[model samples]
Target: MSLHSLDVRQTALTLLRSGVRNAEVARKLNVPAGTIGYWKHMDRAKRGECPGRGSHDCPRCDGVPLDHAAYAYLLGLYLGDGHISHYSGHRTLTLMITLDDHWPGIQDEAEAALRSVFPTRGTCRVRVKGAHNIKVYSKHLPCLFPQHGPGRKHERLIALAPWQQEIVDEHPWSFVRGLIHSDGCRITNWTVRKGKRYEYPRYWFTNVSDDIRALFTDTLDRLGVAWTNCTRYGKPYNVSIARKESVALMDAHVGPKY
Candidate 1:
């Protein structure tokens, strides 16, 4: 009855290859749905049909290049709201990014970013959860996003690897755009002085992880973007760029979200 047994794996693969759905296979074998997916993924890897970056000897192996803008954007997404998980007994990696459904065109931008990083892979699968969130999933996630580790992102030492750092250094604006698009927002703030109404636009990014906060702030500094730090009481740490010129600069690079 063990799901890890070779018999179970072979049966699951056969069922999957024969057009059986993952949920059905899991239900019939009394195994977890994830287990079925893991087996199917492994089988595809063996057949050299795994998506994203392909096999080492693949003719299309020109997989996602290192130090590319798309990779930087994906890294930002990962640091912001993405998650990575490894399938048991397989080399499969699942990368997921969940975004608020209310953000208009953010979902399309996210899909574009993922596709740019995994050109060989088809469109990522999207699932609606709860009432306000959209989740996207792809199997080749780990190849581009290697920041996966134990515990919450803030609790760990979240420094970038050398190669990633190099890419970010060369393409700071894209990195910043990705980070802001995920964890930050551009909006107008209203105030009243002596009964006179005034409105100003700004950019804000917040995160609970100190290391990630530092990374974000440092990148901003390198880009010569001025910002200030504050706290959200019981919530996350905050970094805001409210200067008129700074907001204009960010708009030039990050633009306004559709």
Candidate 2:
């Protein structure tokens, strides 16, 4: 299973396309998962295939670009109507792209991308789990938004500010699996696991505590908020489009929202 030959790399790509995890393929090939990722990137770039690097310009292809809105909308579809994975409660979608971080400008980047390839069925939004280092993330990022400290972004209460909260109340997340965010400002190289504690910065509505938690949760509930959480990914509720609001708050106020 050595991944040294051209045949090995090609076989690995076939395996990945056939729904085999890189780890399993690597094990079968006896190569490292990173090796598989490396080869995949190399092969795609060499072939001149659009890398879908989280951008709206897949000018090479007329299909949907890998934008946040598209991703989020698909996830919501999965959550509301798609079958649950046999191994997981969360419905997951993965993309390999280059980035410097996974937040703040993400919605901006995503929204713009979505508008370019906008949907005719419905509005598109995004809710993702990111990691830190912004490098080669598979699922969740580690150490996302380090400047904000650590743990579920409890300090972001002000993000659900009154008017903003009002918007959430009005829209109420519906038919969408919640978006989970990680600390990765760029790309995620990791995912959550049993032994691994999620060090990525985040905020969640599922099981939110405090009367203040009630404030956020109740508003979302009244508005029909629905999101999903990976015991290993992000929070477990539908993500709100205050994608703009979250950005504004995080950008302007770095402390507890209140």
Candidate maximizing TM-score: 1
C-alpha local distance difference test of each model = 0.73, 0.36
Q: What is the RMSD, in Å, between candidate 2 and the native fold over all Cα?
A: 18.9
For residues 1-258, could you state the per-residue lDDT of candidate 1 as single tens digits? Answer: 352778878888889999998899999998999778767765664443544343542222343354378767767877998876665553455667777777657777777776666655555545576312233345544334445666788887788877678889988888888788789889899999999999999899988888888989999999889999876776659999999888989999997666
lDDT (tens digit, per residue) of candidate 2 on 1-258: 342887777789888768786689989998887777656544443333333343333322333433343443322222211221111332221222222232445444333333433332222333334422111111111111111112233343313324333333343332112222221111113356897844332333233323333444454345443323334355433233233344343323222111
Error of 1 at 97 (Å): 0.7
The candidate scoring highest on lDDT is 1
Quick one: RMSD of model 1? 8.4
Q: Which run of 10 residues does model 2 get worst, by summed lDDT?
A: 138-147
Total backbone clashes of model 2?
32
